[model samples]
Every structure is written in structure tokens, then in C-alpha cells.
Target: MQYTMPTIFLASGSPRRLELLKNLDLNVRQKKLPFTEKINRRLSSNKIAEEISYYKAKQAITHIKNDEILLTADTIVCKGNEILVKPRNQNEAFEFLTKLSDTSHSVITGVTMGIPNKLSTFSAETKVYFEPLSKQEIHYYVEKYKPLDKAGAYGIQEWIGWSKIFKIEGSFSNVMGLPTHMIHNYLVNWQKS
Candidate 1:
């Protein structure tokens, strides 16, 4: 019998994260967390994201071997002072999209890397500006895209993003879900140091 060292463990179930990592050509494993608590908007978005990422990473650590690196991330959308999480239903998704239209919001993604006794955590924030959206457009997107599983009720890689996003002020991959460039740089350096 032989054992192969796993490259990395992705502590998330998000298809977007998996896709991003795959795009980077990184060999990784996916580990889903059992419970995700709703983040309190009263806390800073950066803090909330980091805390959640740490929690998820800790939960996944038990399942991974000490030699495998575990990675976890948490993303959230903030408009003004409000933090919009995944919608509870269609109506909430519609409402969230409506508010996001014709406005500027910030998307924050926190990432954690864990290896045995070592853990590193960081966060990336991207400012996204949206053009004014018509009522029909919002409705159509909500019904068509079914953004209930997405934060801010939308995905930057989707139809709305292609047509409505006017500008992005940070890492585009961060907006997608994971900050691949940052992660790649960190991992490369980690391997070297």
C-alpha cells in the first residue's frame, strides 16, 4: 500500500471556489463544513469574514492529515453598512438585487491556510459598482439566475455581472469567491520559506 500527499484541502463547498482553484491548476481537495453561522453585520466585515474562515478551517482540520494544507474562505457583500448574506428565499434575493442595482458595494473574502500547528489568515476586499437596473431586469435575473445561494444575491461571473457591473476596484477573483492570485502568491512563498 502507498500513501500520496494531498496538495491542499479546500474547506468550502462553493462551486465558485472550486472552479477558481481549478482555473489556477492547483491540486486541491474539497471539504465542506457542517454548520455555518449567520454573520452579524454589527461586526466589521473584515473581522466577520476572518472569523468565519478560521472557524471553517478549524472544523476541516480534524479531517485532514497534518502534512496536507487546509484552506478555507468566507465571502460577504456589504452595501453601506448592511451585510447581505445568502438570501433565504426568492423575494429576499429579488430585494437584495434591487438594492444592489445602481450602487457601489464591497465584497470581502477572508482566507485561512492551516498546516498542522501553523495557520495563516488574510482577507481581500473588492469594490463593485453597478449600473442602474430596470425592475424587469432585476426580476428576470432573480428568477432566471436563482441567486439564493450567492452572497449579495448575485455572482460577478454571471449575466448581471457581465452586463451591469460598471467597475471593480480590486481582485476580480476575490469577487468570484477566492482571491486566487493572492492565494497563489502566498502558497508559492510558503513552499519556499
Candidate 2:
């Protein structure tokens, strides 16, 4: 008898998600998708995240195999009713940092795991409180790290998070993007069924 492992396909281009998946020790293949998602303003942040995650899966539907597992995720930062997306330029990054400083915000990551006949989607929310930051520190992070590609102009694993984040109320990995514990829980059950 021969044993085989399941193939996992990551339908995202995020280096953070890739790194987290690697930490999980799974057989994964990176397939970057031009995953452009639009927000439906009528929905809440959590629903928005899950909708985008499922959309990514729908967009990649043609490429997934029945024997392989396809995982897609989307993350967003929101305060109250406003959602902050990826910064397109330095000024925006600075503004995002300024807005996030000295406040508690929500980091929501939605994940969709697809198999042969089933597609499951869920979202994880983390409350992050940032210490009051100086203008110099905010400027330094925007210039040095160039957080243009990250949502809310920040990465939890980066210097800004280390220096400014005073408290985090949920999974740290969720703030980083992929929610490793959630995925691991799903994967363990996935392997059995």
C-alpha cells in the first residue's frame, strides 16, 4: 500500500499568507491570482471580508482539483464603520498610520477552504490597540518599510506593529493575515474527512 498527501493550492499573492502556510508544514503551491475585490458598502466588515474570500475562490474555480485543497483569504482593517484598504502611495500610508494611532481597530481576515464538493468560508476578527505614536515614528515607518502593499498600511510582523501595538485581543496570526490556528484546526478535520 502507498500513502499520499493532499495537495494544497494557495490562491493569493500575499507573502504573509505564504509564510504562514509554510509554517503550517503543508504541501502547498502558490498560485497568484489577479484577485481584485470590490467592497459592497451595504455589508459589515466581517461579511465584506468573507465575501471577498469567497469571491477569490470563485475566481479560481477553474483551476482547483477535486483531490486538492484550495484555500483563499482576504483581510481588512476597519474602525467603527470605515474600512481602510491598502495604501497606494506614501501619503496615504502616513494618513493610515496617523488614523490608526492611539485607537483600537479591528483586523478581520476571511478564509475559504474548498474541496471536492464543499467550500467553507469563515472570518476571524482581532482587536488591536495602538499606542499613541509620534509623527516622526509614523513618518519613519512609512518611508523605511514602504508599507504600500499591505492593508491599512501595516503588517503586524513589521517594525510598526512591534513598536506601536500596545495590545492585541485575538490570534496574532490573524492580524498578520492567515489566522494559522484557525486554518490548522480546519486542516486537521479536513484530513480526516
Candidate 3:
């Protein structure tokens, strides 16, 4: 059979993901799905991200054409087994960042690539170490960054990430929201087959 390159459909509202894909110079289009991540506490941290991506992919299936593949993802922060998602308000954002202050946490980005007959899912995990943040600093970030839209009340590419993050032990882009290296490898190899 002849292989035809599938048009890429990005099913996420995150500007970070959009920029990452665009930066890679991939032929991609953005269409956000109704995917507010609903966490199942029973699952592991990495599994939570992967499962949410699967749900997002399923929701986006209707928008995909026969010659297109839908890409969806969910990112979460894990401090031990506790999962921190997007905050609902500034106060919550305050609390989330405070908890992450001066500690090591895992940022997991789960991804799904859905085609006509198959769905492939995987997750990338990055270990991020944060410096001790003062109350004023946390408040300042919440006020200035408006981090309610981001997972764990923070964006690794934003001010807090630049200032407060001390170290990262894995894919930097994964902490930003998408794992570009992994995604690129998949796109390259997937296109080949």
C-alpha cells in the first residue's frame, strides 16, 4: 500500500503546545476539544496524563478526517502520588505553587496520536526542582502570570520557571507542555510506516 502523510490535527487549547508544534515546522492545525482533565486517583501519575490524552483523542475523533491524525495531550504535576492540575482560581493557584515550593516534582505530559484505525499513547516525565519561594513571590506570580490556565498553576516557560525552577532532570519541553523530541521522533517514524 502507498503511504500518504496524514494532516496533523492538534486537539488542545494550550498555546504552549501550539507553539511547540509550529516551531517544529510540522503541517499542523489547532482545534481544542472539550477535555477538562478528570483525574482518577487510582491511576499512577504517568497513567493519569496518558488516560486523559486518550479521552481527548476520543472527543476529537469526530473532527478528524480519513486522511488526518488527531494529536491530544494532558499534563499534570506529581509530588509523590498527589496530582496537581490546573487551578480554578488565584487562591488555588497560590496554594498549588506553595506546595511545590522548594521541592522536587514530576511533570508528566501524556500524548495520544489517533488515526483512522488506531490510537497510540505515551507519556514523558520531567523532574523539576523548585527553589524555596516566599509568600510574596508566589502571590506575585499568581497575580502577574495568571497561572490558572496552566497545569500545576505554572508554566515552565514563564517567569516562575525562569526564576523559581532550580533544575530539571528530563525533557525541558515536556515540562513546558509537550515533549518535542519524542513527538518529533514519533512523527518521523510514524510517517515512514
Instruction: Give the best candidate by lDDT.
Output: 2
What would the per-residue lDDT of candidate 3 be over residues 49-127, giving only the tens digit for each residue? 9999998888788888776778998899988878888899999999999999999999999999968568899999999
Task: State which candidate, 2 or 3, has the greater lDDT.
Answer: 2
| C-alpha lDDT (0 to 100) for residue 120 of candidate 1 | 90
Error of 2 at 155 (Å): 0.7
- Per-candidate TM equals 0.93, 0.94, 0.94
Q: For model 1, how does the per-residue alpha-carbon lDDT over 131-191 read when each residue is reduced to its tens digit?
A: 9999899999999999998999999999999999989999999999998998888787786
Query: Ranking under lDDT, best-scoring first?
Result: 2, 3, 1
Q: What is candidate 3's TM-score against the reference?
A: 0.94
* Model 2: CA > 4 A from native: 1-5
Task: Determine which window of 10 residues in candidate 1 has minimal summed lDDT.
Answer: 1-10
lDDT of 2 by residue, 79-172 (tens): 8898998998999999998999999999999999977458899999999999998899999999999999888999889998888898999999
- CA lDDT, candidate 3, residue 184: 83
Task: Return the lDDT, model 3, position 53.
Answer: 91
With candidate 1 superimposed using the best TM-score fit, by how many Å does residue 40's alpha carbon deviate from the native?
A: 4.3
* Candidate 1: residue pairs that collide: none
Give the Å shift of residue 50 in candidate 1: 0.7
